[model samples]
Target: TQLLEQSPQFLSIQEGENLTVYCNSSSVFSSLQWYRQEPGEGPVLLVTVVTGGEVKKLKRLTFQFGDARKDSSLHITAAQPGDTGLYLCAGRPGNQGGKLIFGQGTELSVKP
Candidate 1:
């Protein structure tokens, strides 16, 4: 079984602070996806990194896939109150018929 673990299960910071969330696993993945979920809504796809060492950015959010494809990180610069939400990392195991194995998720609170 593949499992992705996220560090700092919960985080609270003031607005304008910077933060980084990590997802790690011992198994290799074909691809990894990051999503953001707001209260009362389903998660929204933020980005997918298919290549090892690949990185993608959306506004102030940056996502990076590890060189071994077994880990990933998300960095938020100048975080704002609106950025407070639940962040998830899902990996597609190469041998698992492309099904996504999700991490426990990180809950962030950015207060003004």
Candidate 2:
């Protein structure tokens, strides 16, 4: 099974700051997805990156997939206090089963 490694285990910053979280793997994924989970709720899908070098933006958050499709990054601009939560990166690998492999997670705390 391929492993997804995410960086910056935890992040804390003032509101309006910019941040970037990275997810990397040795295996390429067929589809890579990013999700955000609030304190007591299940994660909600944020964005999905499929094509290599594809870039997608949702509001102030931007998602980018590496040319090799083995790496991805999420950049949030002017992060707000409401953005505090756990961010996860997961994907159904090209050769893996139906199950998705997820990163350990990155906890973000944005203080007002």
Candidate 3:
């Protein structure tokens, strides 16, 4: 079975601080996606890294995929209250119909 595991399941930090969340797996994925979800809403896609050792950045956030395609990381720089949300990593299992396996997710709270 394909599984994604996330570290630092909960995080609370003052505004302007930095944090990094990790996702790991034993299986290789063709692609990996990161999502951020606010309360009462669906998760929004943050980034998708398809290549091994690939890195993508969006403003204060950076996402990296492992060289083995079995892990990924998300780093936030100078986090703000607006950044508080749930972070999730998901990957397709290289199967038909494109089913996705999701990580446990990390809940982040950036306090002012």
Candidate 4:
């Protein structure tokens, strides 16, 4: 079974601060995705990284894939209260029957 581990399981910061979250695994993945979720709603995909060393940005948020495809990171700059939510990283393990292995999830709170 594939397992993903996330670091800094919980984060709290003042508005306009910067933060970074990490997700790692020993197994390689076919593709990896980042998602943002709010209370009472399903997670919304933020970005997908397929190639090693790929980077994607959505406004003040940035996502990066590790060179070996075994890790990923999300960075938020000038975070605001609206950015407070659950962040998740999920991976499609190589030949793993199409099931996604998800990280433990990061619960972030940005206080204004």
Pull out the clashing pairs in model 4: none
Candidate 3 Cα deviation (angstroms), residue 31: 0.4
- Give RMSD (Å) of candidate 1 vs. truth: 0.6
| lDDT assessment of candidate 4 | 0.95
Checking candidate 2 for backbone clashes, the offending pairs are none
TM-score to native of every candidate shown: 0.98, 0.97, 0.97, 0.97
lDDT of 2: 0.94
**lDDT of all the models against the reference?**
0.96, 0.94, 0.95, 0.95
Tens-place lDDT digits, model 4, residues 1-112: 7899997899999999999999999999989999999999999999999999999999999999999999999999999999999999999988878788999899999999
RMSD of 4: 0.7
**What would the per-residue lDDT of candidate 1 be over residues 1-112, giving only the tens digit for each residue?**
8999987699999999999999999999999999999999999999999999999999999999999999999999999999999999999999889699999999999999
Model 3 spans with C-alpha error above 4 angstroms:
none
Residue 9's lDDT within candidate 2 is 90
TM-score result, candidate 4: 0.97
The candidate 1 region of ten consecutive residues with least summed lDDT is 1-10
Q: How would the candidate models be sorted by lDDT, starting from the highest?
A: 1, 3, 4, 2
lDDT of 1: 0.96
- Per-model tally of clashing residue pairs: 0, 0, 0, 0
lDDT of 4 at 37: 98
